[model samples]
Target: DQQVKQNSPSLSVQEGRISILNCDYTNSMFDYFLWYKKYPAEGPTFLISISSIKDKNEDGRFTVFLNKSAKHLSLHIVPSQPGDSAVYFCAARPGSQGNLIFGKGTKLSVKP
Candidate 1:
């Protein structure tokens, strides 16, 4: 069974608008959350991350929020640009382990 899930396979948003991507986890052992953005013909790159102890973490136009009780997390991109279009992967690290479980990923298209 997949521990991390991104129910929406894709999302579309207009330029200068906000893009929200949702992720859900089935394991309570997850202690950290990470978001990765992947462009075509390229590897996934780390975007923003949040610890389980905190509810939110922000970096420039990117922000990640975690709800421990609900085992859910979301990534918000403000004023999205066409360059932001890519596949976003939600990953969770269990406890202090180095391994991370990744979701199927949600393809985000920021239209101009």
Candidate 2:
């Protein structure tokens, strides 16, 4: 069974808006969460991450929030642009393994 899940397959946003992507995981042992963005025919690139110790982490226009109790997380992009349009994935790392478990991904479209 998949431990990480992205229930939304896609999301749309207008230019200069805010975009939100959500993820949920069943494993309580997950100590770190990351979000990655990908373009067509390209590998995903790291965006933002959050540790279980903190509830939120921000970098520039991107922010990741983790809720340990709910076993959920989310990524927020402020002033979403057309360049931000891509496939977004949520991933988690367990306390022991360096390997990451990834979600299905959500494709975000930013229209001008």
TM per candidate: 0.98, 0.97
Top TM-score: which candidate number? 1
Clashes of 2: 0
The positional error of residue 7 in candidate 2, measured at the CA in angstroms, is: 0.3
Model 2 lDDT at residue 87 = 98
lDDT of 1 at 71: 92
lDDT per model vs. reference? 0.96, 0.94
Angstrom error of the Cα, residue 68, model 2: value is 0.9
CA displacement after TM-score superposition, residue 26 of candidate 2 (Å): 0.3
Worst 10-residue lDDT window for candidate 1 reads 92-101
| Leading candidate by lDDT | 1
Q: Compared with the true structure, what per-residue lDDT tens digits does model 1 show for residues 1-112? A: 9999999999999999999999999999999999999999999999999999899999999999898889999999998999999999999998896699999999999999
Per-residue lDDT of model 2, residues 45-100, tens digit only: 99988889999999999988888999999999999999999999999998856799
